[model samples]
Every structure is written in structure tokens, then in C-alpha cells.
Target: MATAVLVLATVTTGLMAGLYLAFSVAVMPALARVDDTTFVRVMQRINDAIQNPLFGLVFVGALIAGGAAVWWHLDRGDVRWWVLAGAAGYAVTVVSTVAANIPLNNRLDRAGPVDRLADARAVRRDFERPWVRWHTLRTLVCVLAFGCLCVALSVA
Candidate 1:
């Protein structure tokens, strides 16, 4: 049961990390550059649209399953700190996505096309950098949590 829980947590957190990895690590900086072509703009729109619904699943699924996974081990003699760390990691992933990503998405929606969008620089200045910072932090935390989960798996 513990093994299964850890597996679920591992898979879900890994899935959950996908968007953050793409954005901060991959897309945004690329988007920030370039001449903001139609293809580039459309890609941003598609990427933005796709991520929200996915995150909606990841945030809820990771938490409920992760919590249950941790609970499955808590009173058992096989308990490990990695399990605790993993459970906490999923919890942080939920908080960071909810608190950071969703709002940024909404702002992007409001900002509209990079070409016509007024105060694009303001959005770029005020929102983008901070969002990246928070996402990087979230990614680091999730990675640590996933690492701990891996350790738990090794012991169990």
C-alpha cells in the first residue's frame, strides 16, 4: 500500500511539474525574446490554454492521493521521512500553482496579444519576472519532494 501510494505521488508530482518546467525553464524566456510572431503568439495561447485544465487535475489529484499515500504509511512501522517530505511536496505544489500560476494566466488573458496589448511592458515587468521566480522555487521544491519520494521508495 505504501509503495503504491508513493508511486501515485511520484507520478502525479512529475506530471504536475511539467508546466512549470516548460514555462520558467523553457517557454517564457523564449517568448520574451523574438519579434512576437503570429506563430509565437498562437503557441503562447495554446500553451496557456492547455495548462490550466491539466493543472486543475494535477493539483487536486496529487494532494488527495499524496495525502492518502502518506496516511497509508503514517502509523505503519515502515514509515520514512521521505514519505512525509513527498506529501508536503504535493501540498506545496498545489499552493504554488493556485497562488502563483492561475493568477498569472488570468493576467496573460487580460493582456491579450503581445502586439496590441497596451502596457505590455508593465505586464512584462510587474508579472513575468516574479512569476518565473515563484515557479522556479516551486519547481525546486517539487524536485526535492520527488527526490525524497525516490529515497522512500529505495528504503521501502
Candidate 2:
């Protein structure tokens, strides 16, 4: 049962890590080449699209299952520490998202649509660099967390 839960945690975290990885590698880079209006508009649409239930499940599930993995491994000495570290790393990922990324997203959202804005470049300038930085941070932590969980699974 503990192994199963740990597997679940690892899988969910891996999914999130992959997503962040994709955004950093492919999505953002591709978006970077477009005009400011297209960049802002596409990002806005993506932000809205990503708020759906499925993404929510994987996002929150990683934390919950990582917690459960820590709980289940508490009696296993060093193994427990691995799970705990993993959970903690994921917690950082979540914190970074809420603290940094979401606020940027909110500011971009509040900037209104691209067509109506006087200067999409200004909005993009404010939103892009900071968002990418936070996202890269989250990606690194999430991948590290996934690595910790994988180590636990392998040795357990």
C-alpha cells in the first residue's frame, strides 16, 4: 500500500515536472518569437485553459500523495527521510507557484485583452521575464522532488 501511494505521488509529480519542463523548453521559447499581442493573448488563453479540473487534480494530487508517502514511510528510517524531502520539495514548488507565478498571471489577466490595450509590449515585458524565472525555479524543484521520490521507490 505504501509503495502504491509512493508510486502515485511520484507519477503525479513527474507529470507536473514534465509540464513545467515543456513550458520552459518548448512553450515559452516558441511564444517568445511571436508578436507581443500574440504572446499575451496566447498566454492568457493558456492560463484560462489550464484552470480546468484535470490540471487541478495533478497539481494538488502531487502534494497530497507526497504527504501520504511521507506518512507511510515514517517507520522506515532513511526511506522516510527521502519521502519527507520529496514532499518538502514539492511544497516549495507549490509555494513558488502561488507566491510568484499566479500573481504575475493575475496581473496579466488584469491588463485586459490585447486588442484593447495600448501597449501589449509593456504588459508582456512586465509578465514574461518574471513568470519565466519563477516557472524555471518551480521546474527545477519539481524535478528534484520527483527524483527523490524515485530514489525512495527504487530502494524501498
Candidate 3:
């Protein structure tokens, strides 16, 4: 059971890291080339779409499974540090997202339809650079978490 949970945590963290990496490398870069209206509209749609069940399951599941893996390995001194490090890394990702990205997303969502906004460029201006910066941080943190989990799996 502990092994299964650890595997699940590692896989989910890897997936989340990949997702963030894609955003950092591709999605944001592609969006950056478009006009402000298109950028805002597409970004709003993406932010909305990303909240669906599968994404939620992976996002929340990583945290739960990581926590579970940490708890399960508490008595195993050889592997506990790696599992704890993985969990800590993931926790940083979660905290950063909640503290930074989510608020930016919420602000962008509340900015309403890009076509209707008096200054679509202003809305995009407010959202794009900061969002990209936060996303980059998220990507790095998740990748670190994924690496830690991978190490834990190997050592376990």
C-alpha cells in the first residue's frame, strides 16, 4: 500500500511538473505573440478549462499522495527524508500557486470579456507578465518536487 501510494505521488507530481513546464515553454510563449484581446480571451478560456475534474484530481491528488507517502515512510529512516523532501517541494508549489497564481487568475477572470473591456491591452498587461513569472516559478518548483519523488522511488 505504501509503495502504491508513493508511486501514485511520484507519477502525479511528474504530470503536474510536465503541465507547468508546457505552460512555461509553449503555452505562455504562444500567447505572448498574439494581440491583447486574443491573449486575454484565450487565457481566460484556458484558466477556466484548466479547472476541470481531471486536472483537479491530479493537482489535489499529488498533494494527498505525497502527504500519505511521507506519513507512511515515517518509521523508515532510510527513505523518510527523500519522501519528506518531495512532499515539502510539492507543498511549496501549492503555496506559491495559492499565494500568487490563483489571485492573478481570479483578477483576470474578474476583468471580464476582453472584447468588452475598455482597454484589453491593460487587462493583458496586468495579467500576462506576472502570470508568466509565477508560472515559471511553479514549473521549477514542481520539477524539483518530481525529481525528489523520483529519487525517493529509486531509493525505496
Highest lDDT: which candidate? Answer: 2
| Better candidate number, 1 or 3, judged by TM-score | 3
Off by over 4 Å in 1: 35-48, 51-55, 113-115
Which residue pairs show backbone clashes in model 1? none
Give the alpha carbon lDDT tens digit for every residue of 1-156 in model 3: 889999999999999999999888898889889999999999889989999999999999999999999999998777889899888899889998999999999999999888789999999888888888888888898899899889889998
TM-score of each: 0.81, 0.98, 0.97
Q: What residue runs in model 2 are displaced by over 4 Å at the alpha carbon? A: none
lDDT of 2 by residue, 1-156 (tens): 999999999999999999999999999999999999999999999999999999999999999999999999999978898898889999999999999999999999999988999999999999999999999999999999999999999888
Rate residue 21 of model 2 by lDDT. 98
Candidate 3 segments whose C-alpha is farther than 4 A from its true place: none
**Global lDDT of each model?**
0.72, 0.95, 0.91
Better of 1 and 2 by TM-score: 2
As a TM-score, model 2 comes out at: 0.98
Summed backbone clashes in each candidate are: 0, 0, 0
Which 10 consecutive positions of candidate 1 have the poorest summed lDDT?
A: 34-43
lDDT of 1 by residue, 25-114 (tens): 667677667443443355457547776766668767878877887887786554556788887986887788789866876776676677
